[model samples]
Target chain A: MNKKITKQIKELVIARLEIMPNNMKVSIGSYGAFSKDDLKRHVEDEDEIGKKVVEVQMAFLRAIKEGKLYPQE
Target chain B: MPKRMLVTLPDHDITTYYLRAWGKKAVKYAEDHSIEVTSLDRDKANRKNVESYLSNLPFGMVFLNGHGDENTVQGYNNEPIIIAGKNESKLKSTITYAISCSSAMNLGDASIKAGAICYVGYAQDFMFTLDESNSTHPLEDKLAGLFLEHTNIFMSAIAKGSSVSEAYDKAKGSLRESIMVAESSGNRTILSWLLWDYYAFVAKGDISSRL
Candidate 1:
């Protein structure tokens, strides 16, 4: 929730999005379809769409950390 | 009595264009299984038409494909069709699957309270990646299929007489399989988005209900 953590998460999200193929576009519901560059810009701006992207990234990280993404024993 | 389904396909933008194309599979599956389908497509996917059909028909299931928020799902050109506290009652006696963003957060609950048999949708943004080369032919875009295919699986399961809970479990299973594929492919973009959708997917009301 802090600004420093927020900036870090945004950087992480942008880095993850950068790996997307050039021909691929991500559609985030009504917020519209976004290219890799577009997603990076959204993360940098921290606007509504950017915030949502960050939230998603955070959720993924948490899931991994909690082993929720792993097969349950 | 034969099962009946009502679908709203609103294609006015890039996001909706893909939804409309992929949503057709569910419609087709229903018809092939002897379920009568009433398709309100494009401009016809408006509030007036949805209300008229639901109020006067015996549709047991409704598939809504479009942009939406926590309180409302839009139709063609983003015209609000079902709004929580306003038209949620129209969903009564129907199993509703809204392949839109965030409507499950509130509208799903409202519809259930209004007597809907079941409501399945995403509690957050329904995200997917599209192949721009296949933009003109969305159904051919395999990248988008990673997400939308699970939606089709859910509807198809329901048409096959699976209970709402069983259909939801099958869709979740499909998403898990895709997530494993994305992980093995080392595609962080796909993996992240698939995980997001997996967590956001929700089913409210009576999960035991069937069409």
Candidate 2:
């Protein structure tokens, strides 16, 4: 199968869900586990990870709504 | 055929926490799918470790769980940054499945610029609902099963020569469908499954040629 650019655009749409300021980097997590395989060869699980992103977005939105901050690039 | 290895990673914020949800699930799912799986917990392992592992492996799929910001993916070993570059054709080109958000956001164009097959997890963070049940099995029932479910579906789709998008949508959508139907909002079990299911993803691309 071909590596599709459409896949990234699809993820970009999801990235839009993040209402974060440009400088404010959204921190994810470090699931403590071990791997022998090279880290370079990983396929992203967008849908599942995207779910948590939505919640983070929700949090971002809540922060904005409270006038805590605003969204930037 | 080389043995399959499932590599699990951690995002930034949660990497410090000790939990088997990420690592154990990879093993269980891989076993179910006849793939040999292992995890690289945060700080304990790193890219060098992966290099060693890759050197010994025959060939298979690679699954990553961690914090994927923009162009680079943050792995363990105390913020070991893994850059996705022209190495797509390198390391025998193993297909990747990232459990972190945004790894595939630009269609993996940034990281896989050279050429690679990867399924990245993209979506809003709210999508992953943690298991709050506070019970014994934190993974066996939900996490491992969730990955296994889509993995099986993805293999089926790939066998058909389906495009990456087609296969991803097929497997992802189906995973969503099953979660919606289950709708058991009991303690941590179903809720956590529902939450996590909404986030993760499996990238499309036949990296086997590279490997």
Best by lDDT, which number? 1
lDDT of 1 by residue, B65-101 (tens): 9999999999999999999999999999999999989
> What DockQ does candidate 2 have relative to the true complex?
0.05
| Candidate 1 chain B lowest-lDDT run of ten | B1-10
User: What TM-score would you give candidate 2 relative to the actual structure?
Assistant: 0.52
Show the colliding residue pairs in model 1. Answer: none
TM (B chain), model 2: 0.61
Kindly list the per-residue Cα lDDT of model 2 for residues B31-54, writing each as its tens digit: 665555666665544666666676
lDDT of 1 by residue, A1-73 (tens): 2243366677788888888999999899888999999988978887778888787778888888988874321
